[model samples]
Every structure is written in structure tokens, then in C-alpha cells.
Target: MTTHSLIVTGLAAGYGDSDILHDLDLTVPAGKITAIVGANACGKSTLLRAMSRLLKPRAGQVLLDGKSVHKTSPKELARTLGLLPQSPIAPEGITVADLVSRGRHPHQGLFGRWTREDDEAVRAALDVTKTGDIAERNVDELSGGQRQRVWIAMALAQETEVLLLDEPTTFLDINHQIEVLDLMTDLNQTRGTTIAMVLHDLNLAARYADYLIAMTAGRVHVSGSPETVLTEDNVRQVFGLESRVIADPTSGRPIMLPLGRHHVTQA
Candidate 1:
């Protein structure tokens, strides 16, 4: 069984007067992929933000390694936890290798020394993301898929134990989505990285996540394995849609078949 790497208790936060997350409690299992899924306004991004220390919780606490995130220094916290937002701006003239190497900034001193260890991490990240060939290419010149991989490689180079990614596959084609997800799975398996991602693609989330969290009205509706959470009832309640849940041919995990307006059959 995977140990708990991070824990949140009674977490609540929102924009101004509106409360989006209500006493949300969760545990991220060490070295496992935990995917959070819900409709818009369900506090998916808010939760991820709180976990990454980007947003301060209004009510409860987010604990990293049994210590409150509010107490940890930013640089110290970043050395243990990394966050990848849905969309990130890259420096206009930055090369792919340079962009990935920037991830080692946390390990650098005030003078920003470029150590041999930093170079090794950058190389390893490029190797993992398969972006070594484009190492010297300007990041802006790459396709959307290639750019996403570079961003992921940058996160890989951070060498943090926990990585929280928000919509990691937004601009990629289906194939690239699989490639990135597979890479994340490999990282979890080999390096014991605790990954939590907010994914809109239900089928892909089902295929990749070791644990699934369904949120409704700013609270955890239910959570468990793919087969357990992606049920017809849970789908209808959380997403306001009906769907057939079937086994994934490749992974044997539950795959949701959304029965939206376009997918509904005329009676």
C-alpha cells in the first residue's frame, strides 16, 4: 500500500465572498497518480491551487510531510512540490534545453550556480520526455504537443517528490495526450513521484489514474479506484450526464461513455 504523502483537512477557499470548496478532506497516496474530476465550478482548480500553495485556504490546512504549507518557505516547499498549470508562458527566446534547465532553479544559490548535478537532471528530464533531439530549438518554434512535452520535462527536472498538474493535455492531440500520460505513469512507477492532475478527459483519466476523486458542489462526492468512481450514478450526479461505464481494453479500468445531447439516441 502506498503511504500518504500529503493530507488536507477541512479545506475551504474561494474568490471573495463565494465559497467553492467546503471542508474538503483528501489524502494523496505516495507514489500514486490521483486524478480529480468534476464539472466546472466544482473547485477542481481551486483545490489544486491550495495543494500547491498557490492559494491560501480560508478555513483548513494543507499539510506537506506533516507540516503546514503556510509555514514552509517558498523555495523549501518548491524543492519538495512542483506545480504545472494548464497554460504557462515561456520566455520568447528560450531554447527547449534552457527552459528545462530552468527547473533546476530551486537547487541554485543566490548566484545561480550551474552545477554538474543540474546538467544531469536537465539531460535526464529531456531523455524522459523524449525532447533531447530538440534540445537547442527555440521553445516557441515547437508545435503545441512538443511544447507541452517540454513543459513536462521542466517539471521532471524539478526533481520534486510531488507534482500537481492542471489540465496537462489541453492543447495536445489524442496521441500526444497518451504519450504524456504514459510518461507520468512511468515517473510514478520508477521514481515514486506522487502525481495529482486535473483532467477533463474522463476516459483518459480513467485509464491513467490509480485513484479517482469526484467532486460536486465544492465537496468530495466520492473517491476510489477507476472501477469504483466512474459509475453511472456518480457520472450523472457529478457531471449531470448519463454514461455507460465499461472496461478499458488496454488497462481493464472503467471507461465512461458520455451520453450527452450529441451522443444521446432518439427514443
Candidate 2:
């Protein structure tokens, strides 16, 4: 498996006339699971978009293995980096098999016919995601959890060295969320794929991520191991909430316990 270094240098990007991400700098460690967590409107998704080349950077550059992503050929870049957007549009009536096959696009050359390698990749992806049973089913007909896994299967079929996911667990139940995160871990360990994702659940992120990046107001507030990045003071500063950070007895990761108005009585 090939590992690619992803870095952002002074990145600034957003919608027209407004920048959601400030002069941000980050380096996603090669072959590790890095989770970006933050409050709403903190630019976590914007940073992922910039890294995936979905959104053009206004001021700086995203580098993949020391090469500018903006300047790379789209097909070449796609072959090396796979991105599962927050809300990817599945073509109406497309089947799971067909959607997964589309991931082979970058690997196919001009006038190239679909080969056994493509079939194998697609098959492996579906099997790993446990979507093989629904391969022929319409993607639109699947439940939210199933649909998300199908999208992830498509990304897996891409066979890229770097995988970027924007809220991959969105709309998933607790079990499904754990399943997806576990699948990501399996992929990283087995294939050495670099995984970077934006997650809303701080506890889950801290538990699953080897490295954690916490953002606030368009900049990275803090980033490190879960123990160092997730602390009482950091939580209060970044989330504007009082909370107790406890060690998970099972995994030894930090678990946040948010205290609200009603949770805190006069002491």
C-alpha cells in the first residue's frame, strides 16, 4: 500500500465573498486516522473540501506528497485520493453495483474497457462493506445507514491512498456509526490508507481517531492525541460548554460529559 502526505499551508476558502476557513495549516499524518471535530460553522467541512479539491482555495494550497493538489490532473488526483462528501448525490435509480463501478473511472484509460481488476475491486468493496447482498438493489431505496455504507463502498473501490470523508456518520444510528468507524479502522490497518474525516460526535471521534484536530472559528484550536486534545478547558473554550472529561474504561480514550443549565445545581 502506498501512503501519501497531505498538508495544508495558509489555506483560505469559502463561498463567494466570504471565507469560512482562515489561514489554516495542517498536516494529516500518513497512514493514520485523523478526525476533525468542532462546533457548527467552524470550517471543518470547508477544510476537507479544499483538501479534496472540491472547493478552490482562495489564498493557499493543499499539497499531496509535496505536489499542489490544485495543479494535479483531475484523473490522476482522483486515482490517488478518494473523497466521500457530506451529501453525495446518487444518480436517480442507480444500482449499488453501478455506483460502485463508477469508482473505477480514474483507473480506466481513454477507450479502456472494464477489466477483471475493476470487477475485483468493486467486488471486494461491496463485500467489505457488507453491501454485496444489495448490489443489484437501487441505491435510492436503501435506508440512510445502508446508503452511507454504499457510498463508502464506492470510495473503497476507488483504491486510493488517501481517503477523505465529510461527516461519514451523519444520519446513522449508533450501531451503524460504530460499524462505519470500525470499517475505516480496518481499511487503515489493512491497506495503510490515510484517513481524514470531520466528525460531530466528540466522544466517538476521540475514541476512534489516532489523532484529533479540533477547530474553532475557522482555525484549528488544538490538535493531538485524544488525551491531549480533549480536555476540560479545551472543551469549554472550543464548545462554550462546561464538561467533565473522563477516560473510557474500555479504550482509555477521553469521553466528554457536557453539563447544561439543569445538570448543574447550586453547589
Candidate 3:
């Protein structure tokens, strides 16, 4: 498995005339799981869009292995870096197999034909995501969890060294959230794929991410290991909430317990 480096420098991006990310800089650790967390409207999704080249940066650049992502050709970039956005829409009435097969487009030449290799890639992705049984079903017919897995399977079939996700767990229940995150972990561990994701749940981010990046007002507040970044002070600073940080017994990672006004325990 090959690992790739993704770096951002002086990134400033937004929609229309407003900048959601300002002079941001970051380096995604190679072959590790990174979670970007912050409060609502903190530019988490905007940062991800910039990194994935979905949103153009007004300043600086996103570099993949020292090359500018914005300068890379669409086919070449998609071959190397795969992105699953927050809400991926499939063509109405498309079957699971057909939608996943689209992932092979980057690998296929303009005049190329679909070969056995493509079939194997799709099959492996479906197997890994456990979506093979529903391959013939319409994407619109599946439940939310199943639909999310199918989208992930499409990304997996792309076989990129780097994968970026935007709030992959949004709209998922607790059980499904864990299921999706565990699937991502499996991809990271088994394929050595570099994973960067935006997550809203601080506890889940700390539990699963090897690195944590906390953003505020379109800038990174702090970033490091979960143990280093998920502190009481950091949470207070980043989320503006009083919270307790404790070691999770099962994973030995930090778990944040938010303190609210109703909880009447004076410190």
C-alpha cells in the first residue's frame, strides 16, 4: 500500500463574496485517520471542500504530494484522491451495481473498455461494504444506512490512496454511525488509505481519529493527537462549552462530557 501526503497552505475559500476559510494551513498525516471538528458554521465543511477541490480557493493552494490539486487534471486527481461529500445524490432509479461501477470512470481511458479488473474492483468494494446482496436494488430504495454504505463502496472502488469525507455520519443513528466509522477504520487499517473526515461528534472523533483538528471561525484552533487536543481547556476554547475530558476505558482515548447549566455541580 502506498501513502500520500496532503498539505494545505494559506487557503482562503468561500462562496460568492464571503470567505468561510481564512488563511488556513494544514498537513494531513499520511496513512492515518484525521478528524476535523468544530461547532456549527465553523468552516469545517468549507475546509474539506477546498481540500478536495470541490470549492476553489481564492488564496494559497491544496497540495497533494507537493503538486497543486487545482492544477491536476480531473481524471488524474480523481484516480489518486477520492471524496465522498456530505450528501451524495445518485441518479434516480440507478441500481447499486451501476452506481458503484461509475467509480471506475477515472481508471478507464476515453476509448478504453471495461475489463475484468473493473469487475473485480466493484466486487471487492461491494464485499467489503457488505452491499453485495443489494446490488440489484435501486439506490433510492435502500435505507439511509445502506445508501451511505453504497456511496462508500463507490469511493472504495476508485482505489484512491487518499479519501476525504464530509460529515460521513450525518443523519445516521448511533448504531449506524458506529457502523460507518468502523467501516472507515477497516479501510484505513487494511488498505493503509489516508483518511480525513469532518465530524460533528467530539466524542466519536476522539474515539476514532488518530489526529484531531479543531477549527474556529475559519481557522484551525489546534491540532494533534486525540490525547493532546481533546483537553478541557481546548474544548472550552474550541467549542465554548464547559466540559470534562476523561480517558475512555475501552479505547484509552479521551472522551468529552459536556457540562450544561442544569447539571448543578459547582466546581
lDDT of 3 at 90: 99
What is the lDDT of every predicted structure here? 0.90, 0.94, 0.94
Q: What's the lDDT for residue 102 in model 1?
A: 90
- Candidate 3: residue pairs that collide: none
TM for candidate 2 is: 0.97
lDDT of 2 by residue, 80-143 (tens): 9999999989999999999999989899989859999999999999999999999999998999
Q: Candidate 2: list runs displaced more than 4 Å.
A: 264-267
Number of backbone-clashing residue pairs for each candidate, in the order shown: 0, 0, 0
Q: Candidate 3 at 135: error in angstroms?
A: 0.8
TM-scores across all candidates? 0.95, 0.97, 0.97
RMSD of 3: 1.2
lDDT of 1: 0.90
